[model samples]
Target: MSLLQTAPTCDPDDQWCVWVSELTGNDWLAQAADWLIAKPLALLVLLIIAFVARWLLHRMIDRVTNRAAEGLPTPMLKHKPGKDVPATVLSGRRVQRAQTMGSLLKSIASIVVFTITGITALAQLGFAVGPLIASAGIVGIALGFGAQSLVTDFLSGIFMIVEDQYGVGDAVDLGEAVGTVEAVGLRVTRLRDVEGTVWYVRNGEIIRVGNQSQNWARTVVDVPVSHEQDLFRVQSVLKDVAHEVWEDEDFRSVILEEPEVWGVQDMTPDWITVRVTLKTAPLEQWGVAREMRERIKARFDHLGIELARPARVLIHRDNRAAGEDLETTGAPDGSGTPASS
Candidate 1:
């Protein structure tokens, strides 16, 4: 009875339907044949729709990825006029990010496209879909609890990408690790420190991020002078030194603006600290600071500037009245007596 159940509507005049009914001498057998033929046609339609949707989504992803790779203008970051993008300045990190994002999006599209098609096709084939979806939801919840950390990592990585928190080649401080990011993934981020030690930090474990290579950096130099030196004179000399560096052809490219001399950063009995600061392109701070130090040393030496030095005190003690005996090992007679202070 179940096998002979009624099929969906079919014309009595259909040649195949009629042929099947006559050959088998049963109406139900002909209806079953018609149902079988229709199922394949429906499945073929679903397959075509799925493939088209996937292809369209993949193309969109590729377009966006290519734009990002070329440094497309964003609200936060705009490309400057007349500056070519990434000829020599093009780095591997940007390309990698684009590729990774593209691949992830494509994979997700494929999964969604195939999943929907499969569920719909199953329903068309007369299988009950409600129970299967319900069971899938329960299984999903169980997996969510069992693999909470993995899900957290995946969600965190997605947010980071969407928010543009940090990327490869960026110097960041990620709580337990501080270094240059070498690779970024949905689960872990790889970093290489100054000592060339690589660190793998979990994306879920990152609480806060300190990105040092975002836009610009500042170079700070503190010049310590003898406390007795004239504050005005020291500041003037420092300003001259800073301006001199800024004017240099080699430094002009990196320096963003005029250097500022912040007078009297700190004052102690021994020395007065004069702080100078310069704004430079990202990651250029160290090189500019080194240049500033070298130039300051040379200029200070040329002008005979007095630098602060540690003070030394000498004490004289007479031990004749003390109960302790004084000994002088250097008694010209090769004696073992200890020397006097």
Candidate 2:
């Protein structure tokens, strides 16, 4: 009975000693493991908070910017002679400028957010960012010399913005390339051609610019009437057409000034050139001119006027068979045919 009792007590003491040893060896590791599990959850929560904060900040900034621009008078909102202003849409240039500014602001905001998140993530992982920043500076300096063109482009873009050389939706001709300015940015200018192709021109390379969509555009139309038609009659017809076009539904909105007819600009044996000049709103002159041409055709056709083309009434005579009566003319040599001069 004494031996059994002694054995049980010794066994219980040994078990207790083993449990203490295990705790002493694995305590720090257990705590570290628990922290590792919780770290990911904490990071996820932080990222969610950051995302929500960024969205709210963007909305606030956008609202503030829009509110500041509310008092400005847009072209679309202005009262014109024969135009109606719709309150929903802003003017072309104003809308374009707004979009460009918004893009720039969003880009800057995203850069800021990304930078903060990256730094926070690195710091949370127990990394020293001071050395990283120092290395980044050295590398940036080293790359600066090779990236002079990029620097020039950026600087030129900023100057362009300050100077307001041109803006989106403006019809500009840059050297040999002519197109509508679709977007203007710090590094490059985007252009869209009539063919719907987009061109990217570097800002630094633009030395000459032709802006066609400025205040006004001129529509010059040349109408050719038959030489047989009376000069006064043709001029009278054009003047009437111009007056009617000024009151036209489609053209009344675009024509700022009535078209003035310059009579008999040039004369030929078969045709007389009549010139019509008009002052039209920017980018509206083409449609106005096209409409005038259609009206002119209708007017000429109604008045029984014959418009001639550039073709010579050629006299074809077989010199070898000159004595033979030219089939069309009774006279064998009646100047064979009156060749159109």
Candidate 3:
């Protein structure tokens, strides 16, 4: 008889037939078919959910950034008498900070979500995830011990972002590197120097930072003139130059205050250095200084104010064939020569 028809070998009163029939029933095939189709669908659904979550997270971050940016006070809206922070700079910093925070959040969320998804997918594939998790923990500990510097870098970067130490587009001097910040990340900072060279600096390595574009800057101009020039005249000319620059419509907004002419910073044999100081908006000092120099040169040239020049003096010695007495006297050219007593 066929195997299917020979099932009466077991007693009808016994439970063995019932158990064997159940084991061989269509129910197991249905369950197998369902699992064969459902597991992959479940994994796919999970991945889709992860993608959606990431998108939503980024959307939320963008919303927060826009709201925060809107709340920032414009320079014209709130004019605090000595506060030099520009509205544009503040807005830029806010956006940069928000982006940095968003990147960090997204990175962390992706790690967690992907890790969970992977574990779940593995479990669906009939793998023991508990042992895997334990092994991952051990590996993580070993990596942590081996990559202490990396940990320190991430920690430092977090604090740096939180404290707003520096941001992209800011000119910073980070002890070892001086350049404009191009990007700030959890482990590294990218910079572009004046020479167009790019640098990647570890966040942990930056102990101190000098931000040149913050708030305000001072433009210092040292003009050297012939020592014999009238000091008061030079001072008056410098003051005039400062006043002109301050009142100019193009530069009026950049200059914060009237220029101060600090007279006679130093006196050398050939030149007297007069110091001119001006308080200007951040990043404006260089342009202002250059313009001031050009204007001052024109003014000096127009007024015939002589600048310092190198001077040379010569000494003449005379020798007679016989033992003759020699007398010397100072000449107008600062030279000494034999002369009649």
Candidate 4:
């Protein structure tokens, strides 16, 4: 008779071992003692269940969030008078938040699934998890207190999500630093600057943020010229240039309203500052400004106008006593020699 037949009694001490021995009609208890071998089918089934649960939960969350967000009008895409401009529609802020929400939901679902799977597996192995959970709770509380910054980061991240201040792909000015939001998590936000440098800033530490791509960006161009240049001629030249630039296919597509020259904004003894404003598409202001600069330089060069800057034309002089005077002794017309002291 196998061990299972002999150990038919329900003894929790060696229930699985005895059952396996009885079914196999062999001393598998020795192998079980040496190594706790888990059945592949059971492990595979558990993992599959966990994976499916995670997938289903994630899909549900994404579907719900997307539907809800889509139902509500997104401010980032809508213009609000002076607060927003026609260029706001092109900003990626709203869409980026949707994607970020999806990612966060997916992460949460994965964690929930894994935690359930771990607990289920532990239960199946006949391990008592009550004390483990209690101990874990205590440890977590202690850790939370010790690592208050971590808690602050987590809380701040939650608030950030709720407020929707900025999201991935949105251009933001984090204090003095400016960058596009690449990723936002429970702890840190990743930003890619214009120079391609990535900054990882903790959410808790970010006290204030300036989101440039929130709705629309305003660009101001200042062109300074020497006071010698004619003011009316400069304004007329700028007007003609603006018209030409506006007519251009490139600027027309990016510019919403006609470019306006604000006339002579300021005048000083050395230079005059001319201001021009253009209503451009979001993020297109840079290109428009650059094109305007090129046009200004070309027009100025053609008009024989020079850019103003500080300059000096120095004339050196030297005075000496009667005994060491250049007027007393000279070597040549170009060179002067002082009299002997």
TM-score of each: 0.72, 0.59, 0.71, 0.66
Q: Which residue runs does candidate 1 get wrong by more than 4 Å?
A: 1-45, 64-104, 124-126, 313-341
Q: Please name the candidate that would achieve the greatest TM-score relative to the true structure.
A: 1
Alpha-carbon RMSD to native, per candidate: 8.4, 11.5, 8.9, 9.0
Cα lDDT of model 2 by residue, 1-341, tens digit: 66433332212333333343356544344335434654465567768877887798788657644643453544322223223322222245444555555566667787888778777777655589889878988988877888888988888887776445678777889985689998888999999888888899998888888887655677889887766778788888888988898888877767777679987788766567889888777787788888889988998899887675543334456567444423332232233343222
Candidate 3 C-alpha error for residue 7, in Å:
16
Instruction: Report the error of model 3 at residue 165, Å.
Output: 2.6
> Which stretches of model 3 miss by more than 4 angstroms?
1-25, 71-82, 124-126, 225-232, 262-272, 304-341
Best by lDDT: 1
Higher-scoring candidate on TM-score, 2 or 4:
4
Q: Tell me the tens digit of each residue's lDDT in model 3 across 1-341.
A: 76445433433443433445467754444345445565677788988987888788778756665565564444322223235556653565566666676677667777887888889889866689999999999999999999999999999998888677888888889988899999988899999999999999999899899987665778999998987899999999999999999999999888887799988898776678999999887678889999999999999999999877645433344646654455665543456666543
- Poorly placed runs, candidate 2 (over 4 Å): 1-49, 64-90, 155-170, 181-186, 190-198, 214-216, 221-240, 257-277, 294-341
| Backbone atom clashes (below 3 Å) for every candidate | 3, 0, 0, 0
All candidates' lDDT scores? 0.79, 0.69, 0.77, 0.71
Model 4, residue 272: distance off in Å is 2.7
Task: Give lDDT: candidate 2, residue 41.
Answer: 59
Which of the two, 1 or 3, has more TM-score?
1
